[model samples]
Target: MDQNSARQMFENGAFLVVLDAPTGIEFGIDLDTWETGPLFKGLKMIPPGIHYIHYSVVNNDKQAGIQSGFLHSFVSKEVVVRRWCAETEQLYPSDHVSAEDVERIRMGIRDLDKGLGAYPLGSGPNDSYARWQKLTGYITPAMLAQLLPPNGEFSSATGSVYEDEEMEEAQKALHHATAEPPAALLDTTDRFNFTHSDIRRSFPANAPPEDIRKYSRDKSWLLKTLLSSRWHDNPQDLLGELQLAFVIIFVGQNFSGLEHWKFLMHLTLCCAEALEDRVLVSRLFVPLVRVLCVQLAECPQEFAASVLEQDNFIAVVLETLVLNVYECSADEMRTIMEKEIGGLRKLLEERFSWTLATGRQLQADADAEDGEYAPQVIHLD
Candidate 1:
């Protein structure tokens, strides 16, 4: 972006470490790494304890723009935000908070929970944020749904663990907060009992039914995927969860069942109203490739309007579908996999190597960056 937006990123608690990547090096240092020496010449004035790290440089050349990171770290980490658009402030957001303010904010959190601001999930009122804390251990990029107003409003009490009555009361409060309208509510009356064999049923009469059946019946595949779904409260309806788990299971490493994930994803979208655990729904998308399907699944008008807004999730989603899926076509598949095919079968198999690959191996002809940290690199190390 511009110099203004860059400053905004620094102010927003981006852990903006200035790696000493000065231009014109015979052999360059990874500016993204820890600066072991006094490269900043004291201009960076780093504080001693719990200080938010950052650096400023007028590189004058093209060594700017951290590829796609300004927005990613903005959304990922607990970065501070100055959101101030004033010219000078835009020029220097690092000046937004002083040493005194930093200490005050840290101590304020200490005061909130006697040194722990975040209460255990399900402990506080069942507001959106509380559900988020419950779903994921801590709020990260996906847990934005957990943000709630401070106490004295619709907050749930997060009292001591030993207080049984308080805990019960907290539970009650959370249920109310998480409650939804009738249509949005799931059919809790009838428990769905699904079997691994039940998922083996026909898949469109004209398709490869036998091959699909083989993958579904693979118990080893079913079990591995089942581990994530085992915690269902109503164990009786465990089958329905299992059927959904099939999307991840049947696909396995080869990703044969990608079409199934696409079907399930669209089904989730048809019933666009969430299960009061939007953050859980979001974090299940830790496999970055699912980003697009998840966004369409959210189905918010305002959100759709802001889809063009720069967020790292959107960028990675585009890269996965547009770039990687195209690469898969070299194997002579006529129709390339569409974004509509959910569960991101290709991304899951390729991104994390989710298969028991024995003799088979993935080898790049030349040096290639591919991994979680791959997208972040701008210059070669």
Candidate 2:
């Protein structure tokens, strides 16, 4: 936005990040970091919304930095504080300042601004703020608390068994999923060694009897069933868990985070009505499909049971592409999406008995070519 607009937006309150350490430790906000001398303080005018603060310990050995990050939300003119810990090589948050301190900082912001660098609003260091908002708009404070726990450490609360071995297993699973599963089932380790156990542990166990029957009948049914059921009154309650899973996997550097993304992808793709909306389609659909293409390829059997259920996964995706994508997307976006969708369909057909094209034909016939997609019958047994 223009300077006047920025001034009006920022005039309310600012977020403060202060490093009390003596200057050796490295620090950064979002994607950019300090390469020079000690940046003891940073102050900036922030738009009211959720923002991310990612930082890592600077490696003196000329290698990659140790990255860890967190998310925060700001209301209008709010003051947020974080102090750097040299020994731990991490940031710890401080409570909101008293009224006297707020006045003092506001009055002295001029001199303070001189010492501190401005948090990049739009351009230089971190322009990925828009993407961040898109990915995390559904995340609420209660959701964050549930996912992050008290200390903001994912591994601790979840008892994550993700290790190098698990990573290797994940790699193996990806290769297997991308390729065809062998005729003979290999050792149990090949199937159960990845982070699936950790992910399954976190799933809601006390689903309704019918939902439980659906889950027992097909493990893939568990996700949609959980997604449809509410733990409380809120429709969006499951989103918090999904958000935590995202933060852990994406920013928290945990491999198990993909489980959350997978569940989210299923829910999003199932929303055929929502896909019809131009704004939601442009913002969410393509990105989600892009992720889903890779994921579905990586773990086809993970959703194979779900595919056998009432909703045909492949048909919904294709229908979304054929109907919704062209109208909402530009030529370039449209081309990339068609290519990705084609790849996903090809992968499913080549590797499994059910052909995606057949599903599409069935769905088209069921819809009477009216644009609404329907599922084709499948006999997985």
Candidate 3:
């Protein structure tokens, strides 16, 4: 009813914007022979919003001697507003809610609340349960209860699809389980990747709470396999194998280029340092890692990597630190007679020196004429 509420509702809604090739740019190039345009199109991220914008153009003929080619571009914008039933239905401001839909919703919500549940979705790839998820949103045991046959009962949704008691017994009898449990069914698109597929297991916005422990368990199988590998083996023979595994992992995981590079860098850095003497040596591993990290920092855009599996951005920072310290610990610093602690201290000093040099170089390279932030100032009069 109020202006503030209207504005808030509008901002929270979604929008669909379509961009088309521009057409008909004219000129007074005598006899109207001037062209539509030349190539120059890009995106500018406007404040807080996701936009799917496309850039395209039509050129009847490309220039051979700067005498041909025309360009055109255009965009159409629209919004998707989530309006209230009363306003859209044109009912009175105080019109009461419908009793039947309310009852249906109440029963649905109650059924979904059970700790465990199962829907006899279809036997097909996308069954009734999958449809239910798209419509209702949350996963819970209670909803399963409501969906059971007239004489059936409720139970906590637990274990694998076959491990749950009711569902298991029902399975033996050749019947579908009515157990309603909150679960995000796996999408066919993400089954291959260990990480992304888990994203589908979300409860609908208001679905019941179903125990998701098992469904999410499969997500870690690949990670467990990698961690079990012999990280402390002979570096001369094993580093190559481990690094190959890492490359595959980095490519498979989704994120950004920077992310994967950083993760690979961090894990490799650890493996290098951990096995640094008998089986491996930090001195050798450090240099290889430095090259990778330096390359990662220079790249733009997201990279693919398991580093995202690590909390926050630790993988990125860790790799950068590893590269920084390894540069100093490589040769002259690889002295013996020195305790392990002393080597670590020297490596740290090297990292600090690198940081100082890098900062100084960046500042020195700034353009004074352009009034960059690094411009030196003498304030005293």
Regions of candidate 3 where Cα sits further than 4 Å from its true position = 1-179, 188-263, 270-275, 282-284, 297-381
Measured by TM-score, the strongest candidate is: 2
TM-scores, in order shown? Answer: 0.20, 0.53, 0.23
TM-score of 1: 0.20
Expressed as tens digits, the lDDT of each residue in 1-381 for candidate 3 is: 355753443344322211121232221110122222332111111112211111122235643121211111112222211112322221111123454544443344323222111112244634533332222222122322222211121111111211233344555555334445434443222111111111234222343444244323221222222434432233322233222223223321212222323333344443322332322334334434333332233223243122432464543334333333343334533332123323433443453222212312333444344475655778997
* Candidate 2 colliding pairs, count: 1
Q: Which 10 successive residues of model 1 have the least lDDT summed?
A: 147-156
Candidate ranking (lDDT, best to worst): 2, 3, 1
Candidate 1 C-alpha lDDT tens digits along 73-171: 133224232222323212123354566655554344223222111111122555433332222222222112111112101101211112333355666
Better of 2 and 3 by lDDT: 2
Model 2: residues >4 Å from true position, as ranges?
A: 21-26, 31-36, 95-107, 123-127, 151-235, 263-381
Off by over 4 Å in 1: 11-13, 16-31, 39-101, 104-381
Error of 3 at 93 (Å): 58
